[model samples]
Target: MSQFKIRGGKPLKGDIVPQGAKNEALQVICATLLTPEPVTISNLPDIVDVRKLIDLLAALGVKITPHSPNEYTFQADTIDIDYLYTDDFRRRGAALRGSVMIVGPLLARFGKGYIPKPGGDKIGRRRLDTHFDGFIKLGARLRGNPGENFYGVETHSPLQGTYMLLEEASVTGTANILMAAVLARGTTTIYHAACEPYIQQLCRMLNSMGARITGIGSNLLTIEGVTSLHGTTHRCLPDMIEVGSFIGLAAITGSDITIRNAGVPYLGQIPSVFRKLGITLHIIGDDIHIPPHDHYEIDTFMDGSIMTISDAPWPGFTPDLLSIVLVTATQARGSVLIHQKMFESRLFFVDKLIDMGAQIILCDPHRATVIGLDRRQPLRPATMSSPDIRAGVSLLIAALSADGTSIIQNIEQIDRGYQNIEHRLRLLGADIERIP
Candidate 1:
């Protein structure tokens, strides 16, 4: 096991470039399966999840060529359909939740797909029914063997496009259906679809590859199926969640950092949400410049009610950054409510923050009330375990602002998403070391 030993109370200073978006990378990489021509991608994040997906694609016989540190070319000229049944497929497919997305593209290209039970963070009851149901709605037959713990999709005839109203605006579900719909025959209309930038990027990439899709950034989408798709080059946007985390880190640790190539146009409502927490950000060109602040005050409602930060769909606060928001609130001058509506178990990490001397009330599984310390009292350092990716980074931010040294185990969770995180933070003068 690997752990991080961090000494607190040091201000980080420098320009940090945000890595390519991980969520977008997952969707875009899987889109490569939709075409047999070469699909060249740049600005790919070098994270564990992406590496695993690339390995799985190779196992399925996709020709992958590395061009540079953050660029690759993939050509799925021929694929071994039978590889999906091997033990190697089961082990690798179960290692990452993103692996499930491969089924959609495979079903479109080869008329069949299979995957073992997918694994990811145990945040809540993340259901796969949306994906399976969407596939079935598009004329694919679904099969599952519970005794073997495997799921499969097949269709004798070409998928016939039809209208589908998604149960929820599930991100992965939308990506899967969109991939499957591209090769389907006839027209497909999707209502109440996810409008996140990731989805928009996938649509644009597919369109560039000759799939006709309308409604780029809205809930209603119209897709005209194409018999085949070609190849194209795509560069993903910067990781917005990482940008928000850096903003919170600067506020909590009194650091001044500039995040370059932040894709400011795509970061919807994030800067305003952080501004509500009294953090100062200067938008310099395409970068976000966060200055040092010893204290930040949480804004209350206009009627003197407590301020509440909640997550919603895109153009609202991101659920991924609620943990950072909760940690940033710990040092603010007033109290605020952190309401996580999407996932039930994400707020349980507050117990670890409370152990570090923050005043927090776990109202329930979905909400937490935080009373800030106003920087008068410093949080005491303690050893902790990372439960998930976002929580792991939240704990690291807390440790950097605490009184003494802290040890955090299970850092692999953080590495699965963030690339060389400790090394990146070290460039900004943070006192962090990784040990195995």
Candidate 2:
């Protein structure tokens, strides 16, 4: 267990490149299982969750070759499908939630896939029924041992394409279903699908590998199954959540920083939402530049109601960045409501921010009302524990702007998402150090 000891009130400067999208890397890396040919992925984020998935793939006998620090060529020419039944497999598969993504490709290519109940952030009720429901729709049977938490998705025969109206626009659910549909016979239509850039990238990558998919960027997706898929190179986009986090960091700490290669086109509503918080940012081609600001004001509704920033599906603000937004609001002018609709308990971190002298009202498990200090009251540093990945970094951002030294334990949560976060922030002049 490592912790971050950070001395606050130091403004970070210089350009920092965001890591390749962790969510996209998870999807694309899992897609590698759909093909036996060499699939090279570039701009892979060197984060814990991503690395865990790579290791799981290797454990399943995927040939992995590292070309550079953030690039890998995966060849799943021969997979030991029986490995899914091992006790070691159960333990490894349960380590990270991304482990569940492997089941889709395995079920489509081979006839069976087994996964233990996945482990991840304890944000809220994140159900796997959507994933298993999609698998069942694709002509697979879902099985579970009476006493074990393990799940088995088996396809005794060829998967036939069918129409599936996803219960929710779950990103991982859509990715899993899409992977299976690619090798399925005939055509498949998915309504209410997740059309996030992550899903779009996965769709495009699968297309390059010979799967026919259309209606990207929309809730309706059509996939024409191909008997087999070849391998291709795919480069992940810059993590938009990291970009948003950096923006909030700049605002909270009054820092001047430039995010390199931010993939501006793919950052839907992120910049505009930050702008609503009165943060000044400029789009420089593919990069985002955030200038130092001593004070920023939260915008209210046009009809004179309190400003409410809520998480929604694609094209709306991402739930992953809501934690960042909440922390940034602590120093902004005026009040705003942070609604974490998709998950409960995410707003529980507000207590830590409140302890740092931010005025916050935890209305419930899903909502928080923040009355910004407008920088008049500096946040007092305090020791805290990281609950999850997003909230962990949000707390880190708060620590960067607070007045004294703060220690954040369970930094492994932060490492699960951000790649070399301490080193990256250090380059920007942040007074942060990791303590084991």
Q: What overall lDDT goes with each candidate model? A: 0.93, 0.93
- Itemize residue pairs with steric clashes in candidate 1: none
Error of 2 at 278 (Å): 0.8
Could you estimate the TM-score for every candidate? 0.99, 0.99
- Tens-digit lDDT track for model 1 on 361-390? 999999999999999988889899999999
Off by over 4 Å in 2: none
TM-score for candidate 1, residues paired by index? 0.99
